[model samples]
Target: NLRFNKVVICTDADVDGYQIRTLVLTMLYRLTPTLINKGYVYIAESPLYEINTKNKTYFAYTEPEKTDILRRIDGEKYTIQRSKGLGENDPEMMWLTTMSPESRRLIKVLPTDAERTAEVFDLLLGDNLQGRKDHIAEHGAEYLDDLDVS
Candidate 1:
């Protein structure tokens, strides 16, 4: 396996982005759990909106942040730009605001609760997790050991 010091997941700042990010994290959690356990996995935090007044520019991550920024400025005077996806951002803007080392935001993915995370992934994978849990409780490790070895 190719070993990397870090894995950064960059997605748009929206519901779809969140879903895609979750799927990626789940895959990594199962396939390369050490990546998370070693604090090498991260999610890039891109802004949902960029608000620019005549004097200043602000990046907003949520609706409330946008609202608060607008409330502080003259709505008619300032221009508010919402990012639909990462592609919508210009390279300079994306780099300076989302990718630059000095000001960029990143959320490290750590396996604080591996068991719960595994359970959640099982649920996401659908139906089988509950059955597996029930089966384990009823039959115990002895039953699992009895399965035929290939």
Candidate 2:
């Protein structure tokens, strides 16, 4: 048996990536919840933007960070592009942005209350179809702006 310290979930910084991450977490929460309870699960945050300058490259994970990066550059010529998925990124970029412990940002998966966590999982992913619908009906309005209707 192979021993491991942490189970990191790394995906693209996009909608599809968020869906995949949720599914993986649901599987883990259902099959081996101990990993989460014991603090062995983590989510590796991927950068949303890649800002390339004449001499350097900066990875920004959030809009504010990207703004800050641009502010720092202060009129310096730079090209900003949306970061690609992990599968598309080069080995060096992946290593620098994700695999390297020093540079990577890991959000620990800590479920403080097992009961509440289980309820949420069951309501959303379990066989409770009605519950999921009801939740969407109640909370979906808050996320309407996030929808990609186009």
Poorest lDDT segment (10 consecutive residues) of candidate 2: 112-121
- What local lDDT does model 2 show for residue 13? 91
The top-ranked prediction according to TM-score is 2
Looking at model 1, which ten-residue stretch has the lowest summed lDDT?
112-121
TM-score to true structure, per model:
0.73, 0.88
Q: Candidate 1: which pairs clash?
A: none
Candidate 2 lDDT tens digits, 1-150:
329999999988999998787778877887888888888989999999999999999999999999999999988999999999999999999999999999999989877543355677678878989889999999989998899989
lDDT of each candidate versus the true structure: 0.78, 0.88
